[model samples]
Target: MNVARLMFFAFMAMSVSSVSFAQDADCEAVAGQRGECAEEAMKAAARVLNDRYEALIDRAGSRYIFQYQSRHEEHKAFLDRLKNSQRAWIMLRDSNCRLEGFENEWDKPSYSADLNRCTAKMSLERALYLDGILPAH
Candidate 1:
């Protein structure tokens, strides 16, 4: 009788342990899905911001070209300087964001999301700055 009771308790313990393991797996799977969803959302946001950046660049470039045609040599040099500054700004933005991604192991899932968010934020700021400088239309 004692042997049978021992076997029964062992069976119950094993059943409980299996249920616990399954629950753990389910939780991990759900967490992974949530992480993926967040990453995709971040990417979409970055793409939209990048489009805004490009639009601002187009407007600024058009303004610059118009001004250049009518300006003196000094003004033309100033415009050239602005062009150089913009190229440098692009390099800076990319490098800075890459460094942010590397802060916690570059291969991690969060790293790409961090990089995307950083790029989006920097581009948006640059676009706003360009828009502020552009001639009001």
Candidate 2:
């Protein structure tokens, strides 16, 4: 019994670790675009990806809210609360990213890069969260 339990836990640990590694790889790929778009005209590619991720997050959240409302029509107020919470989260995310951008007080482009990375990372996380809550189709 003890060995069986240990093996089960070990498998669970590996599963969790692999999921995290996959997430890290995804984030790295998102951040890696900086190198490809380093040229002058395409400099804002990171920011564009961040915006795209944020839009996706918003769409996922809306879908979740719609599903929730449909399933719980009596709790219509939940939709408003979710909207308010999402707005607050967006403000917090922007503020946090701005703080990250200021980590290197002098280099403007470096700051922009850091800020865009932060935004992309956070937006991806939010999108993942929203997707998890969405009703299965």
Which stretches of model 1 miss by more than 4 angstroms?
A: 1-69, 72-79
User: lDDT per model, in order?
Assistant: 0.58, 0.54
Compose the digit string of candidate 1's lDDT tens values, residues 1-137: 36755565566456434543453354357775634544454454456455655565555556556655643555456567667878899799889988887875556767765665566556545644554444335
Point out the worst 10-residue segment of candidate 1 by lDDT: 15-24
Task: Estimate candidate 2's RMSD in Å.
Answer: 8.6
TM-score for each of the candidates: 0.49, 0.49
**Candidate 2 C-alpha lDDT tens digits along 34-64:** 5333332122333443454555445555654
Q: Could you give the C-alpha RMSD of every candidate to the true structure, in order shown? A: 22.8, 8.6
Clashing pairs in 1: none
